[model samples]
Target: MKWYGASQRRGTLSRLAPDGKDVKAVTLYTHTFFLIEDGRSDEQKQPHYTAVGATPEEAEAMAFAVYQRAMDCNHAMQQKGPMLIECSHCGIQRRVLLPPAPPVAVTRKAERRFFNLF
Candidate 1:
């Protein structure tokens, strides 16, 4: 997905999900699960998941951390700033503050459609 400009001073920025639909911001949050096997029942436990922040500062920190961790092994990390991260569980959306001047584009190419197959 292409990144857009920074959020509007802690406001909800409409973003398209991987499916190319207008999904709520909260849908971006990813959840980490822990397996807990009990004697009788097996259950999955989730301690914490990544989430966007209400303020620019908080959003920036979260986005930076995510970027750093993802590219730590490769050593090819790009700086980022306030971004919108969605909550995987609750479907809550928030503005995550990131580094200053995050890589984002103001516009994107229009989506192409294919006709019926022959």
Candidate 2:
């Protein structure tokens, strides 16, 4: 499937300081696994997976494990799209060309056609 609004993967700019300063870290109450959704809206990406942790490190480790497990099974994955990764309290965008899922399987039923001639 094609992802829409690819440019809005990052967080909003208003959250930054007025003096054009970037904050290094933000307070995290609980570690969460959020999927960098495919959209260009002015909204933060929500967590799609059910993985959660008490700390950022723990959550990240779990996310990595999930990634590895997925890659292990998706042997037919194609290296085409850029995978967006979001860490705890950080809005830095990384451009890593990770392999996407395999193409969907399309099966059609075969129908026999009969023709009558005089």
Best by lDDT: 2
lDDT of 2 by residue, 1-118 (tens): 1222222111212222234464543333222233344543333444223334545565556645554443234223222335654332322222344578899999999866667432
lDDT of each: 0.37, 0.38
Candidate 1 local Cα displacement, residue 41, angstroms: 46
Question: All candidates' TM-scores?
Answer: 0.22, 0.25
Per-residue C-alpha lDDT of model 1 across residues 4-95, encoded as one tens digit per residue: 32111123444455545655454223322211223322222211224356555566566545433432233232323246444443332333
**Deviation (Å) of 109 in candidate 2:** 40
Off by over 4 Å in 2: 1-50, 75-118
- Kindly give the number of clashing pairs for every candidate: 16, 0
